[model samples]
Structure formats: structure tokens, C-alpha cells
Target: MADNILRIAIQKSGRLSEDSLKLIKECGIRFDNGAGKLKTNATNFPAEILFLRDDDIPGYVEDGVAHLGIVGENVSEESARDVDTVHKLGFSRCRLSIGVLREHDYQGVSDLQGKSIATTYPRLLGQYLEANGVNAAIHEISGSVEIAPSIGLADAVCDIVSSGSTLLSNGLKEVETIFRSEAVMIASKHLSDTQKTLLDQLLFRIKSVQAAKN
Candidate 1:
């Protein structure tokens, strides 16, 4: 049931979307990406692009609904999906860091013991805490994680930090970096021969673009 056109899922908006589309363009693939469109077919390549929330990309790829995806390593690791990382795009670099009130005493990971932490990445935070044997309670929140410490929602917060400005402005300071992340391309575990052939061509173009930039 595999079609000649391969499908790739990418972030609909936010940090990763623009770079994802730029990568496609650099690969010499042409498509109409009008706002409000969920999907579009490539005019010059045998592929289709599906615009979706970054959170949903892994699942779609894992389920083979999408043959491939572009997302941040932070999300890819957290989702723990059965997709394979095809290439690292080297964009959208950030770290998953643990932050607490600037005035709070944080000697080490041990300081987090018996504390409450707010984060969107519960699984990753949990793994880090467990590895350090710091049995802290995780308060999973979808957004405004920086406010967790100020509003007394939690003693610490774990979230993505780019320049640390968000944490600094919120009266929080990063005490530990749990994980480093960058944009990456992921493919479904199973791909038809035709799809794999097309993917190889896409990868060649992508590598050429990346090489030209570096």
C-alpha cells in the first residue's frame, strides 16, 4: 500500500518549523506552504509535507502515518517513540535544565532531594532524578514552567532554556543541565523499498545543504 510519494511531518509552528521548511527548500524541494494549510505536496519532489504540532510528529512517524519527521532531540527523547534518527539538523539547539529560585541554595543534585519540581518533560526529568538517586516529586505542567518557582507551584523547575533569560527574568537560575538537544530528522522504523530509495535521495540533498553551510 505504499505510495510513490513519501510523507514527512514537521512542526506546524514555533522554533522548529521555520528551520524545517528552510531545510526542505535547501534540499531543492519546492512546495506551496501557505498559512493555514495542514499539508502540501512537493512540486519538484515525490514527497508530501504534513504540518503538525511537534508533540505529534513522533507518534505519526512511529505509526508510519508519516514516513519521516523533523523535530528537536528534546522532544524525540521525551516521546521515546519507535522512530529512527536519520540525521541531526544542527538547528534549534537548547538544553533541558533544572532551575530554582536565584536565592535558593543549590549545592548539587542532592539538593533536589525531597523537593518538588515542575516540568513539561516529566519522563526525562524523572530519569535524571532517578539516576542521581534524588527522589524528588515531579509536578507536570504544560506551560509557564518558569513561574512554578515564583508562584510556589514547585521548589524547582525543569524546562528548555536557550539563553537563560527566561529563567533569569523569572527570578530563577539554572542549577543543572539535564539534557542537550538540537533539531533532528527521524524516520519510521519500517519503510518500503521505494520510500527508502526516495529517502536516500533526500538525505543526499540535505547533507549537501548542511555541508555548504558549514
Candidate 2:
């Protein structure tokens, strides 16, 4: 491993991982991620890969644990982590939304007053509710927020809705969208001169690859 190598954080599993590796390969950056490994060293470039949860990427970058990261914009914004969004990856598009039972007569945002809402993104949800002057209760769940309404944990759920299958399966209807999101590349505030040079090269390759796709 190079002493001045750059470290890039990426999701270990789920939707974005395969595409992230594919983009790296398309950019001629060769690296091997052995199964069940938390970190991998790139062979063709001075870079290391750190596998982690997508939600944790922002913090990793902000803390300088990883020099850069690929993460969803929603997670990054929700975390309120101090980092720079270098580029948009144009994948994993979704919406942060307020969802409720299909039968509920939710005419407007004001209707949620005093109601309990379950969400993974409590900070974002709380900000939205407060802005709308809706004094709803926000229940913070790590995951499976969609089931909160069905199981009576909350009257509604503020969560990511993609394809609407999960919400449909859970018998919830999206009432309002809090934010639109997609995958983005982020970098830490502090970078050594060599690290910055390498990152610029990587970003150039990424931009070329992204442009080719468009």
C-alpha cells in the first residue's frame, strides 16, 4: 500500500456498491474487493477502499477517516456532516417523504399536528415539520420505518420512497415529499497536497466516466 494513498469509502452492500465498483473500473482504476473484507487496496492506483453502511459515509468523510466517499445526498444532508459534495453520481434517486395509511384523510401538512411520525431521518423530518408548523412527534428508528404506521408505533412515517413498492407493500401512501436525493461524491475538508493531486485525478476520471454515460 502506498503511504500517500487516498482512501475512498463506499457501501459494502445494497444498490450502490456494484455501480460504484463498476464506475471505478470503467475509469481504469483497478481494485479488488475480496468477499467479506472491510478494506481493499487498489492495484492500479494509489487508493484504498473502505466498505461501510451508506448512511455512515458522510460522517466518515467529515471525520477524515476516509479521504472521500460515495453516499446518498439525503443521508449526507440528514447527518448535517461537514464535508464537500464534489460530484453527483446520478444514481440511487429517491425522495424523502411523509407517508400515511391509505385511508387517512391527510388533506395537507397541517393535518399532521400532534401525530407521531416514525423516521430514520429525525433531524430532517423535524426540520420539515417545524417549518410547516406541524407539531408532530418524530420517532427515530434505525430501519424498517415503513412498518411503524402498520404496527401502531406511529401515525405516519417519514422515509425514503423509491419505486413505491415498499410503501405499497407496507400499505402506506406518500403524502408529501421532504426532499429529492441521489448519490454524490464527497471529500473531507483537509487533504495533503499529494492526496489532493490524486483526488483531482480520480475526480477527472469519474467525470469522464459520468459524461460518457450521459
Error of 2 at 26 (Å): 1.3
Q: How many backbone clashes does candidate 2 have?
A: 0
lDDT tens digits by residue: candidate 1, 47-79: 999999999999999999999999999999999
Best by TM-score: 1
Most lDDT-accurate candidate? 1
Relative to the true structure, how large is the alpha-carbon lDDT of every model?
A: 0.94, 0.90
**Model 2, 1-214: lDDT tens per residue?**
3338899999999878888878778879787767899999899899999999998999989988898998889999999999999899988999999999998988999999989999999999999998998898889999999999888999999999889999999999999999999989999897788989998999899899888878
Q: Report the CA-based lDDT of candidate 1 relative to the real structure.
A: 0.94
TM-score, per-candidate, Cα-based: 0.98, 0.96
Residue 149's lDDT within candidate 2 is: 87
Model 1 lDDT at residue 159: 98
- TM-score of candidate 2 on Cα atoms, chains taken together: 0.96
